[model samples]
Target chain A: MSPAKHPQRPGGRSARVRDAVYTAVGQLMGEGRPDRLTIPMVAQRAEVNPTSVYRRWGDIDTLLEEVSVAALTREGDEPPDTGSISGDLTQWAQIIVDDITRPQRTRYLRAMVSAREAVESCPCWEQRRGQAKDMLARGIERGEVAPTEHQVLDHVIAPLYHHVVFGLPTDRAYAERLVGDVLAMARPADKA
Target chain B: MSPAKHPQRPGGRSARVRDAVYTAVGQLMGEGRPDRLTIPMVAQRAEVNPTSVYRRWGDIDTLLEEVSVAALTREGDEPPDTGSISGDLTQWAQIIVDDITRPQRTRYLRAMVSAREAVESCPCWEQRRGQAKDMLARGIERGEVAPTEHQVLDHVIAPLYHHVVFGLPTDRAYAERLVGDVLAMARPADKA
Candidate 1:
């Protein structure tokens, strides 16, 4: 979870403090269940005082939600504009695989997932899905396929996360094959 | 979890006791994290007395392992010999979606998943995967496309568990689509 490459955020003392907090959350999550995390523990790890952490984030749940928002809002999360939805989706999926597969970041990613599950819908997750939808809309406009929501997420996105979380077959091959399957399904039915 | 189905097992006093214990484990899991489970709590819930519970199972880990074994061993879990592997899989996947969707079973299934993740590895889950492999073997023997292990589990099976655990898009249609994608992948590429 302690990655030198912080996902996003520019330089400033306030940003440093926020990065420290998010890092602490990621580190702690890597160790064990998210349910067991507490503000005091996170503050101690962040080297920030408990009072300030609470004053800013209010509670563990809120802190996690805000951090997730930061992770997804980074422009890096968007698929490259490779001129086709499937192309963009494949690249996005590969980045996701790479992101979670980083040796130091795996636990942090898992921890974030566990903690996010405990909270209401995270803004970052919602925002990511929205980005996917926007790409799909563009694909429809380009006459690639009729736009649909559930299939892409269910077939392509869901399986990737499942592999990472369950310790199943995961790697570049898994990501490529998964993208292949999604594109296979997303290709529109033949015209009469 | 505690469904009246009792899955599979001959009737007897010993069987009744085992069933009671499994039911208690499920009930307790629904209430809280599995690591937090205690013998006294299970005993109180099962009405079997703490000493007897301890004497039979030895520990929480063993008890959970045995319950999962019972679940996977149920004869009903077999994919019906519906003339083809894909036919059997679609039906089995549908049953899974329906089983988890049952109002009474939702919490029970979630509890079982929570408990399974806490133990070394879930016997029922392993057994289920084994079943998928066996069916695929039959497909290969029948001159069907050569099937590999990860594709079926990764593409076909993992998504269902992912949906259930994450509370993502879940419905009969989703399961059907998932199975369709797997079959489409499993099909011989040269056949296209």
Candidate 2:
């Protein structure tokens, strides 16, 4: 019988093992030495057998990818609805900058980037894009002239991530300025 | 005797060893497996003693830093001069996207970022800022309304690097669009 045919119950031994493994991965990533992470090391930290980690995640890259997706896309982490696109984007950008600029978060981000292989899609970026789409949809519903999701990603989100990853100075003011610049790209009707 | 008191000759054995080591580091980085790079591996690749590599560079981080700075700031690598600010920025942005989007270059960039420590400044960023300043200086001399160096960095360079690091879609058209957006921030006199 396929493993998919009998899904493990939540809070069962399987679920607890998965939770412990993910937590151990998070702790290791937090230590800021992604280069040293190995399956044996993670298994030791998680109190699980190395063969189990290998069987479940396949490899370090897949394990990292799963952990990053879980960490970045936390439940209830929706964009703010401040009644206008400008307000929403400014607040969202500030939140992003504030969260990502922390040392631990930066390390996690760098670790994720380092572990990535040459794939066409980035799950973390897709998550951010989905959030951007949610914000844009709200603004459109409110009769506000909204920038495209690509504009938000390119102008605001991309710049913020660029500054963080490259060790450039970033703060709420920088985030607000990016939001303002992208908002300026909206039609003249919005300006009027 | 202080090492600073006796600087190595430019074309001496020291310089030759340094060149060989740097080339080895670049080759290993291009191989796209930074996590496996070590002083011993680099020494083997460079045909130098591991003790010599450690004595010269101290550690992997320092060696990677020096090599990245050297590779990124190669001689005669300047932003294109297109006479007009818009043309110059558009061309420069496109060039940056083209160069950084290559698989090898992307791997090298990720390696550099992963190897970095929490420092106040980034040498590679400073190098790019210098190039941006040069482009702005030429635009000013040509009586073109020019954006500040920071503006160019935030709007154009940051976005390009962001896309590269995150595996997002980027091309010449995207680069040109960013150039246009930043150029739009110039004074109305130029717009007129």
- lDDT of candidate 2 over A57-103, digit per residue (tens): 88887787788788766644688988888888988898888888988
In model 2, the Cα lDDT at residue A113 comes to 70
Tens digit of lDDT per residue, candidate 1, span A26-136? Answer: 777666554356889988999877876787778877887676566545546555667788787778777777775553344444444444345545465466577678778
Q: Specify the CAPRI tier of model 1.
A: acceptable
TM-score of chain B of each: 0.75, 0.86
Deviation from native of the Cα of residue A162 in model 2, angstroms = 2.2
Root-mean-square deviation (CA) per prediction: 7.6, 3.6
Native interface contacts kept by each candidate, as a fraction: 0.26, 0.59
lDDT of 1: 0.64
DockQ of each: 0.24, 0.51
> Candidate 2 lDDT, tens digit per residue, B1-192?
113222277777678788889999988887777764789899899988887778788888778877877766664577888788888788878777878888887887787667765445677777888888998998899888787888788888888887777677889998998887777655443222
